[model samples]
Target: MIQNEIIETIETIETICSRRSVRKYTADSVSDEAVLTMLECARFAPSGLNNQPWRFIVVDDREIGRRLSELTHYSDIVASAPLLIAVFLDTDASYNRDKDLMAIGASIQNILLSAHSLGLGAVWLGEILKNKESVSKILNAPGSFELTAVVAVGHLDESDPGTAERKALDEIVFKNKY
Candidate 1:
């Protein structure tokens, strides 16, 4: 029999393992409490020199979320999600953009993992930054930060079968020097 702690950890793994993109959500509104909690989880992600260049902007306003959804081609599945967070890399934040982007990716992962643990679903959408002008005006992003990714979140409307397929272990793994 598994110890209680191990069982709990197993459950978390199961939740993460079966997680899937959920673009459809009920009419439920995401509370500020949930949003804060998710950001709190993101706060601890590793950053170069602990600079923590990632900034999370919450879009709860249906109009604003809709605007961003349309601007980024976030899709109905993503648009229907209750909340969206714009993850930014504060390039002028005493770090280079490349390092900031890596940190921002970690921060985004934190948000997604937290959502999965909470029975919510999140999808990481990239490159909306290519339309920087629109997204900047939409979110009113600060000059110091460059929008890198967006995360849409909500309670999943249906079941999650499993993770996407992975390359065979042998295909990716390498020994000593590869």
Candidate 2:
């Protein structure tokens, strides 16, 4: 049991560390099974009071994806990726506003990590929030749903997108108090 646990832990760490924001992807489409697996992982993400306020609008239509791409600077990725998932906060299901938003963020992270584990590349497009209203309208989402993020996903074109540099732990972490 311990050996299995350690192996699982190692695999999880590898997946997290190796995951990168893939802006380029192949023309091939993502499988329905793969997309559903990602969403299943997202639904299990921790939520405040277990309200589970996160809602997703999966957009696979090329025309709709193009329209959405116009709202973000990451237009190339959005327009070209085989799949797009618009994460939304269902206001009616929220408990506390701030906590629910954090929960939604966790949900989005789950989607990204799961996509990576499934050998699919995904980029979370938050800059699209500047045109949140327009995005909502395009997706025909309910008024109660607030746009949180748009993730572009597909089979990666690049073999390795490469890792980004990060600040040392000591620079960001504090023992007790800052």
Candidate 3:
């Protein structure tokens, strides 16, 4: 019963599931159009009470990207990517901080899915997360929004990695009463 778009999205998820933390990329840039589309998808992710407390800041300027890379101690992986997304969680949302954080995490899923569907590659940049305040100032983000993480994206330099080793289903899945 899947719609064509839904089926395409499933295939996209599978492709992204094979994605690795790509550390290398050519200097080619990601188009503004692609970045726009990714943000559009992120805008639609579910949020608690529809609070939708996420603000996305896209950084594609090489100098800005380099400065952000420096401020957050991002590795070559981040520096090489043509696009960097500053995922902001609006703390002023109608929910508690935890809810805001949880909601932002869901929105990141949408970004990933959309990027994958578009044939671009992205790696979740976690180090940027540890330096939120500094990152905010560097990016000129509003004080009300908290920096959560950066998603570095670009055309990949390597092929998609195959299925990863995962825990057995029996080990993690539980029945209704478990």
Candidate 4:
């Protein structure tokens, strides 16, 4: 007899539905285990030629977080969160530069969904991209690594911003050709 029985699981669609961008956060801290778990999800994301050129800087230090907050438009949110994760792309390791970037985007999506499923509030701030050179220096990123985004993570506050409206499928999808 086969010993391994399949376990029932929550629908991924439901998790997708529940995912939202949370800007405000509570004082509660996100555990290191939680951060690792989210990154593990990101680790599984597909990459071109399996380069997997994603690098991350997890900043739990309040001073560093404050500095990062100051550098981004979402200053209040970044400063308030218990943690900040700086996502990076390795330009030199990429098999195909442009395709590699799309892989990094997949990794980011994994982090966001993983955060939501774990009951943590998180937000992705692209403001850092505008000052990538300076921000990369601040983070001490390797020459091959390019800073892409910064994600703030913490406990969800009472005032949830709720889900923003999204365009209907019909509005975005096109058959065969555009």
Candidate 5:
């Protein structure tokens, strides 16, 4: 049993390392089942007081997806991806702004990792905050739900070799003194 747990731990770490912001995607469509599975994984993300304030607007319709794409700077990428998930926060349900925002971030990370684990690609768009009001209206989200991010999801185009450069542990980490 311990050996299985170790293997699972390794797999989780590998998924985190392998994930990349895939900006390009194939023409193939992402199934509804897959999207539901990703959301299920996200539901388990930790939250302050177990508030779990995150809400999602899954846009699979072509016209709605196109309109949502227009709301973000990553228009081309969002327009082409087969799926778009509008992540929102229920302000009323949150304990506080900061903690809820942190929880939302964790939930989105879980969604991205879950997508990668299921052989789907996803990119988080925070720029939507610039036009949050417009986006909120477009998605018809309730007044209490504040738009936080727009995630474009689909099968990644393998032809594009996206880079995932990062600082080494020695460069970013510090001792207790530091």
Candidate 6:
């Protein structure tokens, strides 16, 4: 049991460390199963008071993708990726606004990590939030749903986007108090 636990821990850390924001992808499409799998991982993300406010709209239609792409500066990736998952916060289901938003962020992170593990490249397009209303309208999402993020996923065309540089723990983390 201890040996299995160690392996699982290593695998989890490996996945987290190696995941990257893939902006470029191939023309090939992402399978429905793969998309569902990512969402499955997302749904498991922790939420405050067990109120899961995260909702997803899978945008596989090229026309719709193009429309959404125009709403953000990351238009090239959004318009070109074979799949886009629009993450939303169901306001009606939320308890505390701040906590629910954090939960939604966790959910989006899960989607990104899951995509990496599945050998699919995914990019979380938060820049689109500037036109959140436009995105919501284009997707036909209900008024109660607030657009949180739009993640573009597809078969990777370019080489692995290795991890970016990060600040040392001492620079960002404190022992007891800052």
Return the TM-score for candidate 5, rounded to 2 decimals. 0.95
- For each candidate in turn, the TM-score is 0.85, 0.95, 0.84, 0.90, 0.95, 0.95
Candidate 1 lDDT, 1-178, residue by residue in tens: 5699899999888866776656566668777788888899999998889999888788877888777777765557446777889888776775666777788888888898888777777788775667867887888888877788889887776654424777776788877354
Candidate 5 residue runs with Cα over 4 Å from true position:
176-178
Candidate 6 regions with alpha-carbon error over 4 angstroms: 159-163, 176-178
TM-score of candidate 4 against the unseen true structure: 0.90
lDDT minimum window of 10 residues, candidate 5: 169-178
**Candidate 2 wrongly placed segments (more than 4 Å):** 159-163, 176-178
Tens digit of per-residue lDDT, candidate 6, span 1-178: 9999999999999999888888888899899899889999999999999899999999999999999989988899999999999999999998899999999999999999999999989888889999999999999999999999999999887775745688877888879363
Candidate 4 residue runs with Cα over 4 Å from true position: 1-10, 176-178
For each candidate, the alpha-carbon lDDT, in order, equals 0.77, 0.92, 0.78, 0.85, 0.89, 0.92
What value of lDDT does candidate 1 attain over all alpha carbons?
Answer: 0.77
Q: How many clashes in each candidate? A: 1, 0, 0, 0, 0, 0
Which candidate would rank higher by TM-score, 1 or 6? 6
